[model samples]
Target: MSEGGSVKRSRCFPAALLAVTALGAFNAAAQEPPLIRFGRGFAAEEQVWLMSARPELTPNQGKKYQLKQILFQANPERFQAFLAGELDGGTAPGLAVIFARAQGVDMKIVASVCLEAAGREWFSTTYMVKDDGPVRSAKDLKGGTVGVVGIKTATDLWARAGLLNASVVPDKDAKIFPMGFPGMGDAVRTGKINAGTFVEPFYSAEMARGGLRKLFTAVEAVGYDHELLDIWFGEKFLKAHPDTVRAFLADYVAVTKYYLANTAQAKRDLHKAGFVRTPLEIYLKNADWKRDPAARVDVASLDKLSKFMLEKLQWLEKPVDVRQMVDESYLPRQ
Candidate 1:
């Protein structure tokens, strides 16, 4: 699980110098830079696209890096490894960035890895129950059981916030059953839990299982066009390989453009990655993937997200100034 815990929406912070200290062993071993290994979490289109190009980007490419696929279930520990400088750097959720910073991890957003072509939306949190059970809407679950990917996860956080805003508290109105991302959907279907909060393929999967309904979607609550995710790297890695990082970014933009332009092929590859389902057209059309020239760090957006996480006391301390965390000198200005 991530380092931080959930807090009330009104939580505040007085700020601190740094609650986490650097790992000394990492600094000493910095002389022999390790190979580049990509970290993956969840089966979003971004991971599918990235996985296809792994060889050229890693040890197979004769580069001092090796790309390994880690399940989203292991992202937290993998992210901690990147922060400790044991691994080069990799992709993570936007919320992971917030939690990593709270742990004093030295990392930065490299580029917009994925954007929502379909836009932010209240994706259905699949809810299931006995054939005779009766519950619907965020309001219907009072004193019921709700399944989720994890506590303090972005999905869980927003679900709670949205329910409260709707006047339904999870603990008071319902109990949250946390499970790994992979198992949550099936668990819901088997009647082991009531509803499950998930993203992408799993959300679609739950619906396919039948008898499940969309309670609420994250996008509906946060606005449809919200930038809910990103990819990032360690600051040290960026400083060590500026030219390489830039080349990777250029390729990333090109690759994503390719993915969008030839979405047919992209879907084929994505489906092979287990990130999508059959009928390529539906996945292509339904996927919220998007890209932009301005996909570089949006300081304003980052600031808002950072402050929101801090003010919500999602971390051990307040977030540092957004400027301190994001350095856009590498990205060609839009």
Candidate 2:
């Protein structure tokens, strides 16, 4: 009887171990979270927030979701990657997003990354020239060449508006030479271009170098309040992963708050992330991380950009429905 009982217990032990192993596998599968691929362009305030948000989005952390950020050299490249299904979402200049939507890219403007409002001079793109150069003002750019990061982007639009305000026709009075933001200052300094546009970190670095002067800023050019950059998610991603999208926005808002509250720390983080090489003091002095905590999309600003793109620049064949392009449903509840 004892021998029979021992054999019976041995058989039951194997069965129990199998059940436990299967349960463990099931639990592990359940604990695994969905992965999100997000694309960002050049180092900017938004990218800083994104980098800060990354650590908090781990599988066992805030959102319990995994985030992967893909970097692109320019906004157009970022948007193109999103359209090609290489990215789940991306950051782009608001104008680029609008133009892409007009061209039938199924994407939605989920949040505003950066905005230029009246009295908010914190974040802006500056038109810079040699401090000792003959170009004293925007009007001086007439018949001169201006370097821009891209055509029809926020920088291009702002540069054109500044020149136009000074009675200089963008195409006629000034020619736009496309170049990288990092090279813009050197171009202006060496006369490769008459003036160049520099944003944020690059702007700060150039200012610290002490040989350039700002001719105008984007905020000064487009005076009324507007979004400079917007956060967009592919429509298919939104539809397929609504929960993940909501989680991402929540984490993004939290991270943005962290950025605003601890700006000094954020700047250090940006340097560590290889976004900027400038000293902290220089970055702090010239970089502005102003953003609305609610991450609300400004419809009025969107309308303004669309009108400028379609009517003024003639960059778009037709106006995009700004109202349709924005979907605020994903924003974390107030």
Candidate 3:
């Protein structure tokens, strides 16, 4: 299990354009109605539950906000929309925050929303192959094939990072094929791939199949690090309604604490958000969320992780200033 993980998005950056378009809709909607429309995507389940549940976790007050749309696009597109002023606010990957700022996108990370505190790192289930198949570890497969999701996803970054950690260069030493998570075990079992990266529910599913073996998870390979998912707002929104931003932060923090303290409610929300299929207990068995008292960007840790990704995985076009993208003033001070 490899764990881990944009700009001018088109299909390459639809999320960017979408963000701008989304924002215009919000503005128009605001003028005509009391509704506050939100363009969001699924990340951590808590966000949907807290923001919509009783006592609303968002800072929008009694204005009434609706999750207008949920797009599954990656970070770059989402931030692109924010920069274009189409989206009022949305969550994005940590790296996207830096990339958007570097490009002068006019957005800032206002609060840390979700944390992958405890979960499977990058581990694998064992798949049987013909005797000619290569052995486990990069050292054995100088020219073997492995399965990964998309090249730009966290899974890919972690896979490449894991390779670097193992002293084997991916794409140079081994070939990585793009495939969905569901196909990983099948690919390995049928010898379509040497190994595949699987996480959580998938991890437990593969394990139960009795063919896969654990390789190494993100924690085991990358250390006890955290994966941060955050809420980023357009600069325009902050300038126009700074108190609204502060209120949002307070509600966000309160909801996070509420969710952690009352997991059943959180799980119910997760189920609604479609992160888990079965009971909340099944999903919780794989992943748990963590909240920082102050959910500001962990600048130093992000820098280290970003540098590793850029140097090893060539994920970014240029280096970024983590501090500039992170504006913690909106979060309430203890």
lDDT of each: 0.58, 0.79, 0.62
Looking at model 2, which ten-residue stretch has the lowest summed lDDT? 56-65
- Name the lDDT of candidate 1: 0.58
Candidate 2 positional error at 122, Å: 1.4
Q: Which digits, one per residue and each the tens of the lDDT, describe model 1 over residues 1-334?
A: 2334434322433222122223455554564434455566555545335445433322223333234444444567778667555666666656667677767878877666554233343233333443345656667677667776667666665566556656776677777777876777667667777766766655555556666666656554443333455667788778887765665555556566566566566667767766554456556545444455445655565565566556653443755665666665665445
Q: Root-mean-square deviation of each candidate, in angstroms? A: 17.4, 3.0, 15.5
Please, what are the lDDT tens digits per residue for candidate 3 over residues 186-269? 787787887687755666666666666655555444554544567777777778768767766676677777776777777777
Q: Rank the candidates by lDDT, best first.
A: 2, 3, 1
Looking at model 1, which ten-residue stretch has the lowest summed lDDT? 12-21
Q: Which parts of model 1 have CA positions greater than 4 angstroms off?
A: 1-35, 45-48, 54-72, 115-133, 270-286, 297-301, 312-316
- Once model 1 is optimally superposed onto the true structure by TM-score, how far is the C-alpha of residue 206 displaced, in angstroms? 2.5
lDDT of 2 at 84: 73
* Candidate 2 local lDDT, 250-314, one digit each (tens): 77777777777777776777767666677667776765745887888888888998998788778
Clashing pairs in 2: 143-173
Q: Which prediction has the highest TM-score against the true structure?
A: 2
User: Cα lDDT of model 3 overall?
Assistant: 0.62
Q: Where does model 2 exceed 4 Å of error?
A: 1-23, 46-54, 57-64, 118-121, 273-275
Which run of 10 residues does model 3 get worst, by summed lDDT? 1-10
